[model samples]
Target: MTARATADSEERAPWLPMVGLFLAQMLMSFNVAALPVSIGGMVEDFGVPPTAVSTAIVTYGLMVAALVMVGAKIGQRVGWLLVFRVVVAAFAGSALMMVLSPSVAWVIAAQAVAGASAAIIVPALVALIAANYRGTQQATAVGSLGSARALSGVSAFLIGGTLGTFVGWPPVFVIVLVLAVAVFLFSFRLRSAAGNKSVDIDVLAALLIGAAIVALTLGFNNLNGWGLLQATREAPFDVLGLSPAPLLVLVGIILGQGFLVWTRYRTGAGKVPLVSLSVLGSSRERAAVYAMFIVVALEAALNFTVPLYIQIVQGRTPFDTSLAMLPFNLTVFITATLVVRSYERFSPRVIGVFSFMLTTLALLWLSFVVTNNWETVPTILGLIVFGIGQGALVTLVFNVLVTAAPKELAGDVGSVRGTTQNLASAVGTAVAGAMLVGILSLNVGQAVINDVDIPDRLIAQVDLDQVNFVSNDQLREVLTRTDASEAEVDAAVRINTDARLRALKLGLLILAGVSALAILPASRLPGYRPGEIPETLVARDGPTGPDRDRSTDGTVLEK
Candidate 1:
């Protein structure tokens, strides 16, 4: 063998640094997953409604989405390693705050801090991986990030559920603190390029993008409460006669367009843009972004819907929620880790298409077979099938984006990925809730009007206009205060049960349709597979090229 080839064969990247990156990812995921698990404890402790606790979850996601672009630019200007370590320590502090929170307000504030820290950590993961690994090793590292996400989901649900049930909710966040500390210590092993002092921060671009993301996240999150069209009583404000939610969404879209226009102008003027548009320059890269958004959104919707059913509708415990979701979460973890092996055999285009097909079929199966009992054989099988698809797609689209960008612009790529994912998650969860509730309202209203057993007095006792998902037992309890006869109570309970099941089935069918539609974008993934894209093609959309230093052994180094 040639001397260079021999040297290359001998130089293997150590896997120790990856442990730190993995833990960093899990720290964020676990914190988010633990929120719902501890909702009951939080509600009891604070004497607030469950929606108050949910606001904390929304706050974290909104903060992350709003500031991630700015975070990426900051990381590039300030060294990634320095910023990463600082943010990891900050995350640890946030966990401590969570453990000692005196009120729901403090809990929200703690998550806000954690979200700000995560905004930096998200992009840092990509840049760090590029700094530490190359070729096959880099591919493994990228796939491991996806596995870490899946593994964290399972761990958070199982561990947080047990701890919250037996000990208390505060102990759950202690795990996050331990994880952050471990990541901080292990971070010493990672290598990063020096910060580029010349890189400019586009303040205008930051404001425009930040405002747009905030508006979009809030609009989507409040669609059900604020009203999808006309004004609802819960709406804080209205635009003319319509709900402010849709108006905010429209304004967000306009601001997003302005940001893009400003970015193109800035890039053409030879000034540093907030993010390099080159990340989305190619058709394949754009396709990867689209696929990533859809998959993440679908995953978020399922995560929200399943637990909402188990905990609220069926009145099951958090541990039961964990058990019901075990099959899907475990399958996702296994699939994400193993899918890297198939990259050598099948192209991204093939994998993307196949995965979408699997998701579509799985959702269709779920729509037909799912019942209130999530532990049923057919329901579990459907979840596993969906998990396989979700796992493969998550890793596949991420790898595609990672390979398409030159090492110098890895942070920008990371920012784009973060923005798409966070936005998609918000949209997915909002749409699912709105769609299901809307359907339920219709089903209940129609059933009440058509049933001959229902009397006007009983109907007047309930505010049909404020209908939402409630259990049969909850409905019965409410009716007890009224002079509802046994037959009337039974009728109301039957109507609620049928309406909820119908709504769930229809919602699943709608999600299946969305998965089917996403196949168009999946078809556009790269037709070829490579361990890593060549720098020549990656640099085609921008001025950046082979501008980084090379070691004496001729290995490409991060810049």
Candidate 2:
């Protein structure tokens, strides 16, 4: 039998099934972007505090990190096509629930469901791509998947913002549901070709991993609150938000991770662990994984901060903000496709270095150009450059990681990649949020000093604690509460604007500096020609032969 026949005797062209999978994956990516845009509306509709509303975001990441490996194992057991279709259908249903949700609790529940489904769908797609395509074609499929994800991200913001403005945020979920349904219909064509095998899932390990992720993410999320209170306030008998005791969360994280390590060590004697920590036992893969974290952190920070700047500082409406980002998304989609096609021709290291250089330069340009009088043209151009660079960098990294792994171990590799990406995103958000808050606070204090014409001695006498951050509503409230004249309020407004602008500039500068550091590791990526399989691919599982049918438990079939 031919390789294609051996791989999937009943299926049609491999590319067709891949296309369907890609579209389903896009729905998950879309939700990630859409939630941020709709967060404010959710806050109002659900009457929840900012922290509570933000739970939707944290829970999504936590669920993906906790369950992705389990999902991958399940897919390998039942068949990728069955798992993909079922999970995607669940995702679509969850989205519909989100659209109809009337309360914050409902929204959180829906997001959790969606997140779990997404975790299953994503890793399965990675395994499916590995099984179906080889060489440059494999690289292209991976790149295309990355590009599609990026595009969906951009579209989620644009579409969600626009739809929310006209019909409210609920409609955005409805749109996602429609798209998911289309993908599901197409998935039917791919069923026969997918592998059906059996594997035992480590439920206890899954629980431990989930606990570890939750503790770690919650620790980072509350880090600022903890730091601020550490000096003045007594440490809560319960640390952060973990119950039972003051160091409960910290203890849980350490213990849970320890349990995971112990479990993996025990399992190594017989069955493969949920994630093969052994993959990074090699020096090269360790460095590659670290590089992946940095790249993801940078991307996540940029995505979060830039949109806020455009909407708040520039006074652009949400819809307009999304439209302004189109240039960036378009550049990413086009350039990423080009890079994937050409990656084999150049070293990944060379491509990665160039990508980082371009991204750093773009961020630097953005830092200079983001002013009170910023225009769409220059902002869009800078974003375009950043997007292109990020697209290429991410695609190259994904290709390297996937190709480096043994075929039997793709599920574990995908889990690690997914986990790293989520952890980086959570950390990046916390870091950026803290920096932005600190900068704004400083700016507000300076504005009070520079823009206010109040007597210096009188200003010194006023309690700084009495002053609040100046939002539009806060400005009005301050005018009503204070005995200040109209001119004084005007002066205060000017000072506030100056402080905000200054803070934005400083934040952008910091981001640019961080992006520049990516260049160092990117320079170390190995250069392999397009279409040429690396020595790693040849070493372990050479070309899969016709007689090699295997169960998910890694047992070869006797044909």
Candidate 3:
């Protein structure tokens, strides 16, 4: 049977079913990429602060991360195809709500709906691929999903920015609505297996994991707002004068440990766990997870910092931000699509190590040569180099995870991927923001104490203690309200500009150090090349399933 299937695959690749899967991935990516572009317009329309709009983004990630494990179980209980179509329809409704939303609260609610749908879709994509394709074709299918993400990001930034500027923010989401309907139409061409009615969801496991994810995400997301260690004015509640953010993170870790203990207990008792521990059974698989987390966190940090420097510090428009980022995004899209060709030539361990080296080098180069202007040739080259590494790592680690697990556990692998990505993203953004602000404050304070051009009175007039990332123009405007002479104002603006630049450069250096450390885990990836995935795939029961031996794609092999 496996021989016949292999011969059939050699004759024709299953490209048709992949179209729907690719589009489904793009549907989610596009919505997320469009958010930052639409922020300005959303603020204008809803008459709310930008923070209110950002809450919607946070809400979306929180929901997806919190429910993804439960969602994977639900997909196993119900069918992937049926649930996928239903979620696509639900996502379309969220888009419609975005178009008709009357207030900021409505927008937040709409994203929550979209997030729930995405939770199921994330895991289902992996499961469906496992069911539909085999071997090389399955590898190609996996790479295509990465390309879809990069392509969607590029498209969303360019298209969403244009639409928001010329048409309106509401019209940006209309594309989402159209894409959802198109994906629903395309889904008819794909195939899925029947759901297992005997699958049971452990409620206690679900609560433990979900609460842990929620607390972790919120804790990281609010590190800057609520303070990292001490309580801040923005903190809603504190414990013994300490910030709730770190406490929440500590609590999340404890809960996560408890969940793992419970899962081990369940598995030993011969009951099905929410996610089979076997999916992460080997050191190689665990290494893949670690590498994935580091790469994703690095990507998220760069994504947040670049736009922040361009738009906020340089006072550029969203269109300008898109244009500046085009090189990096386009490079990522191209590399992710083509990196699979190299799999035939290199082992996973080699590729992983080489990719991390590229990322580390790129960040170090950027730290030294990057200017305030993102469009400069040196800066663009550095971004392109980093993109190549990032694109390859994302696809490679994902393929490792997919090939390592059995067909029945593909959904679990997907859930793990989604959780890692969302958590890394939140943590990356928060750390970058906090780190830059802290560096800027240190630099500003030194300047004030040493530079004789500025006086104590000038510092006292403005809130120097809470100094933020601001542009020269903004600083000057604030200084104008004070009874200061031209020399004092000029000195203050110079300090602000220099401090911001120094902070950005130092932050990139720190990120480079992180990328350098990631090579350790990358070296531990499987030493086998493409088509050499191990024969010891784990089953729901133990080391092997009841049926005959199967390929990574779930096709039965000759016994």
Q: TM-score for every candidate vs. truth?
A: 0.94, 0.84, 0.95
Summarize candidate 2's per-residue lDDT along 1-559 as a digit string, tens digits.
Answer: 2111122333434688777767876887888888878877887888888677778888888899778878877777777778788888888888888988988888889889988987887777777777776655667778887888877977897788888788788888887898789889987766434454647777777777777777767666554454333321323344343333224357557867775676667676787566666545443455567777877887777766766666655556777767776777778778777887566357677788888888888889988887765455777788888888888887877777676665656666677778778878877776776577677767677767675464455455445533323454456455656666667667767776767677767877888888788777776665444433343333223322232222211222223
Model 3: ten consecutive residues of lowest lDDT: 1-10
Candidate 1 TM-score to native: 0.94
For candidate 3, give the lDDT of residue 309. Answer: 91
List all candidate RMSDs to the true structure: 4.1, 6.1, 3.4
Write candidate 1's Cα lDDT for 1-559 as tens digits: 1112232564578999999999999999999999989999999999999999988999899888888888898899998999999999999999999999999999999999999999999999999998888766777789999999999999999999999999999999999999999999999999999898888989999999999999999999889999999989999987787999988899899999999999999999999999998777666778889999999999989988998899889989999999999999999999999998887768888999999999999999999998888989999999999999999999999988787677888899889988998999999999999999999999999999999888998898899988898878899899999999999899899999999999999999999999999999999887655533334422123342334322212233233
Off by over 4 Å in 1: 1-10, 531-559
Stretches of candidate 3 above 4 Å error?
Answer: 1-13, 533-559
How much is 542 displaced in model 2, in angstroms?
Answer: 7.7
For 1-559, candidate 3 gives per-residue lDDT tens digits of 0122333445355588889999999999999999999999999988899999999999999989988888999999998889999999999999999999999899999999999999999999999998888677878889889999999999999999899889999998999999999999988988889899999999999999999998998888888889889988899999999999999999999999999999999999999999887777767778889999999999999999999998999999888888888999999899999998887668888999999999999999999998888889999999999999999999999988887677888999999998988898898888888888888989999988899998888778887668789888888888889998999999888888888889999999999999999999999887656534344532233343223233334432222
Clashing pairs in 3: none
Q: How many clashes does the backbone of model 1 have?
A: 0
The positional error of residue 127 in candidate 2, measured at the CA in angstroms, is 0.8
For model 2, where is the 10-residue window of minimal lDDT? 549-558
